[model samples]
Target chain A: MTDQLSLTLAALADPTRRAMLLRLAAGTATVNELGAPFTLSQPAISKHIKVLERAGLISRGRLAQTRPCRLEPGKLLELNDFMDHFRVVTEQQMDQLETYLSELQAKGTEK
Target chain B: MTPAPLTVSRVFKAPIALVWAVHTDPKHQAKWLSPDNPEGYLSKLDFRVGGTHHYGAPGPDGAIMYGTQTFREIVPMKKVVLVQSFADKDGNIAPHPMAPTWPREILSTTDYEDLGNGTTRMAVTWVPFNATTVEEATFEGARAGMQGGWDHQFGQIEAYLAGL
Candidate 1:
């Protein structure tokens, strides 16, 4: 079975779906409401919603009138946690290593 | 089946000796380990087979999360194999504070090659060490999901979208 994180990232790679998730993050939205911001058709919006639902980024409620899509904060937070660690590995460390290595090279030239 | 190890490589304009020295030296390590926050991320290394480099990395929540890297093999400037894990201040292996499901020990190999042009190519290959199925899956997902610059945009969009 495919993991949830990989699915979430793939679902997020699309700008339209990212916008849809952003809208849902504010609050739950119906399919029509989600597609209102973009010029996509109902089927197209439904397709994106299906991807988000399958990825567990959003959940569809069985409300009688409209099945609203609510953001699943858990998966998104997991991605965020990964990003935080990624930042430490990148911003806090490797860039500095590069600079230090270059400085050592320069110092060796001066010696 | 074993998944392919995640490898990250970089080539530096310095010689292999300097590159290897920086990798093994504690003083040099403390300098760049957290270049912006010297006092935040602490580094103390005992470089030898089975020796450990215990350090604290600043967490996202403003806490210092400690980690330890134990040397499994040190082949001088050619290669160094280490087991990396989260740890307590005393350097005992521990679960990650925020991500407990993350691999407890990651075996990594760092190889330094002299390109004969006064440049050194360093490659670090990482794999989960003695990890559970879930832990291995976690590492695999993290490795694949994070291999992009889109992560930054995701953060920014999340911040604005979530109003956090």
Candidate 2:
């Protein structure tokens, strides 16, 4: 899952790729369709789709002669889980900090 | 319950311009933003009103954390408002997968105040927008933990700036 998330993030880093994701989220489309708004060639769009497929964020299936790409929500779930881990670590540290601060106040009062 | 707006405010001993530069410049931002991301990278940044920024960085365990923001308001050295979301491969906006409860979009605002004494006060606020019941609940539930994460991130920025 972590491996998948890293791939997804790396793939999504580019604005072009992120735009592709947005279009795919709306509905599946062919490489040519994805390229239309960006004014890129079909081959260029295909490359982006390939990157996404490698990241497991999307998959391509042949519909007739055209290869249509579809968004796979599962990998996104994996990435979200990875981000949530930070929340856990942060809260634990905060708990420890609060305890230490209270102890400091107590010691000061004792003095 | 709709969560109270989540915020992370920090005071930095730098002039407002310098701090705003750090916040707005993509290269400078990549240096200290998103501390959880060890290899922070800002892929695309459009700093004007209605501009968009796409950012990605390697998480602690080596996964990439990617997010996008669209600028809605921009005021020189004073305020910036934007809408942010997670993006999928096609650059399409997506929601947090695991937190199906999370709002699909977050409205974020950052205000900078010149505090004199070479210091700048920054306050950032985030709130869910047009969220479903689950999303709103998830945001409210995660508030405390999110606050903790932001606190750590601010500390990281302070340290990085101090080291410079």
Best by TM-score: 1
lDDT of 2 by residue, B1-164 (tens): 55578776767656787677666876655555444442456477877887888877555566666778899999999999999888764457876654443567899998999999877787878888877655665565455324544334434433433443
Badly placed stretches (over 4 Å) of model 2 are: A1-111, B34-40, B144-164
lDDT of 2 at A36: 86
Clash list (residue pairs), candidate 1: none
- How does candidate 2 score on lDDT? 0.66
lDDT of 1 at B26: 69
Indicate which candidate wins on DockQ. Answer: 1
Docking model 1 quality class: incorrect
10 residues in a row with least lDDT, candidate 2 chain A? A92-101
Candidate 2 Cα deviation (angstroms), residue A68: 56
lDDT of each residue in A4-23, candidate 2, tens digit only: 44455556545577677667
Range of the 10 consecutive residues with the lowest summed lDDT in candidate 1 chain B: B144-153
Model 2 has a DockQ score of 0.02
